[model samples]
Target: MKALWVVGDIHGAYDKVRALLLRAGLIDFGGQWTGGDAHLVFLGDYVDRGPNGVGVIRLIRGLEGQARSAGGQVSALLGNHEVMFLAALVFKQGDPHDRLGFREYWLENGGQPRDADQIEPAELGWLAERPAMLRVGDWLLVHADSMVYLKMGGTIDDVNASVRAVLAHANPDDWGCS
Candidate 1:
């Protein structure tokens, strides 16, 4: 809760994200969590559109544990790009529910199959488990600047629950368009 740092949409740019974190004293050059009791919040879109999406994920996930051990916290929120990536993994391809094909859609949106191929199970679970929204003090945080969160639920908890349910059910209609 103290010294909160929020970052938005890395889009697989590992160098930039890591640089910011290092510069902020959140992590060291070795990518260790150096900010004791400071919180780092990643606003998702960790994959797709660029190389090293998986690397970004690995950094965030690794930092999460390290920071927690050091009395700090790290949180990553789900973005539309993450949604597209997951949908691509699940449905693969073929337009279902009158939307673009999942795999093809992701590719068109700058998805990298290499990232998908190298993604570990823990990373996959971590990505899928990310919240779509959060509140830190007076600041309301969400990955995308969109009104779609409103339709999910009136409350943050409700909206996150709705998202989790959709993901759990793997409904093409619910997650197809991001």
Candidate 2:
């Protein structure tokens, strides 16, 4: 069997996340991908609630490319927090989905202002493009442990396609869920 690793709710804390990966033998001190072809799955919430959210993002984004080049896979799923982050970035206010206002919504939901300010265009795109769920062998990999995915679609591809559509829309009102 292949080496499979699952990580959940980073919530910033780059040093801690890095330490976890390091201890897992997935990365080295220099922050290079050392896991060979092992697959690593990050179950979202990569931002908010802690310091160094942007640093955590950079590390994961960097690792995505490195892992791919090394014939490994890095599956970073989208949690509700990421949805809030994207919504906060694109819309300043007046989102029907967020009565508190998009920016305010994010803040109330553990968003870090510094992290929001430091986000790059590429990073935003990367975050938005993340899958909501995935499957590895018998593992039904999803960020949220909820039945909401069942309403999204019948299969993994169907669910992803549905989420991609939701994410692709310019207006926040079009997003049925956040």
Winning candidate number (TM-score): 1
TM-score of model 1 relative to the true fold? 0.93
Using all chains and alpha carbons, the TM-scores for the candidates as numbered come to 0.93, 0.92
Model 2 Cα lDDT, one tens digit per residue, 32-131: 9999899999999999999988898899989989999999988899988888888787776665545547788789989999997899999998888898
Off by over 4 Å in 2: 94-100
Provide the lDDT at 135 for model 2.
Answer: 90
Instruction: Give the per-residue lDDT digits (tens) of candidate 1, residues 156-177.
Output: 9998988887877656877743
The whole-model lDDT of each prediction reads 0.86, 0.87
Kindly report which residue stretches of model 1 are placed more than 4 angstroms away from their true locations once superposed: 94-99
Per-residue lDDT, model 2, residue 23, is: 97
Give the Cα RMSD of candidate 2. 1.9
